[model samples]
Target: MLTGQKRKFAIALMSGSTQAAAAIKAGYSEKSARSKGSQLAKDPDVIAYMHKTRGVEESANPEVTKQKVEPEKMPVVNTLTGDFDDPLDFLKSIMNDRSEETDVRKDAAKAMLPYVHAKKGEGGKKDAKLGAAKAAHSKFSGMAPPKLVVNNKG
Candidate 1:
């Protein structure tokens, strides 16, 4: 019974979008979106659609609450699970997944970046062989040379 826009509104609501936002996404007029969303949410057809899609039984259910119920949480992928081919692939997937939390995605990106791109040390050009050599020279610059004449007395 739900039309295309109404169905879309229900789906957007199920996906955790606010009523006003869901209405806008469903192609409702912005000026009256809030009122439209509130009315659409109370529509029996939209309610039925949402209930059907969520796999809830109309008969068994007593009262239908308007509160947002999020779907089951995705399992945390900390280590290299066999489901993915390798560690890099696994991390990349986590990083790219839009549904993932911002912090988690950032962590995944940090974990995956070293493998995909080379990590350069702090503040230097790509070819810093001369700088490295200078560092080594500086390391030994403090020590004085041994006394050659004293060694001859032995």
Candidate 2:
């Protein structure tokens, strides 16, 4: 039922891209892609078609599952003890040790960054971007949108 940019946009949407991004991917002009994508996604027929195609894709590829792991949830082991341990503690110690090689300490701090809280407004800006993306996605898909939880402060 869809062709040209519509078809390409739908395909992109099914691949987890936001509608606006999909529009641009489908060859829509950058100046209007966001609005065009939003408009296309808001169409009932487009939503229905997407859901139908998604259903077929899901059935055909039943083994596919998205990996949604957060860094903190990843299992870390202390090699010395051969036991589970908080990786953040190791990173923090490395960062605080003035005698450690500068590069090594820098690497440790960089690694610890994901565990650090964002400075005030930084999180808000990220959330706003995510919101726009989600809004575009939810408009065209007849499914619940996934929520992104950002933990900025340690």
Candidate 3:
């Protein structure tokens, strides 16, 4: 039966495990394993023994050098002249055109309501005229508020 600190050292050596595992196998409580590992890791004698036993001059496993292949550059698309330069530029131009079309549609909606109401025969009768006025008002209500051009010199 091993005795004293040598018993701990022998158990640590035979276990071929981490200090925590060695401590636990040597009758130490679970809670003491962490402290035992930490102390063992800091011990000069234990470190020298481990270094000698493992026969590791430097790192046992050397880092492997990876050969990196450079990524191929993509072709560009010129949007203004409708020529292919980069794919990203093509997508940006398409989105801009879509936004312009949306604005045009909104303006057209504001302008076309009166014509639409007239075609529905809404201008002749009093009830029809009131309904047309209500419809026209509602249509323009959703448009951006008109810019106020105030002359301060009154």
CA lDDT of each candidate?
0.76, 0.68, 0.51
Q: Pick the candidate with the highest TM-score.
A: 1
Residue range 2-31, candidate 2, lDDT tens digits: 555676786677677877898999999999
Write model 1 residue lDDT over 52-98, tens digit each, in one string. 55656565445554545564531233443359768888888888876
Listing every candidate in turn, what is its Cα RMSD in Å to the true structure after a full C-alpha superposition? Answer: 11.9, 28.5, 25.8
Ranked by lDDT from best down, the candidates are 1, 2, 3
lDDT value for model 3: 0.51
Better of 1 and 2 by TM-score: 1
Clashes of each: 0, 3, 7
- Give the alpha carbon lDDT tens digit for every residue of 27-137 in model 3: 667898868766755666555443433333445454311111122221222335567486545445554553233444445555655544566553558888788778788
2 against 3, candidate with superior lDDT: 2
Highest lDDT, which number?
1
TM-score of 2: 0.34
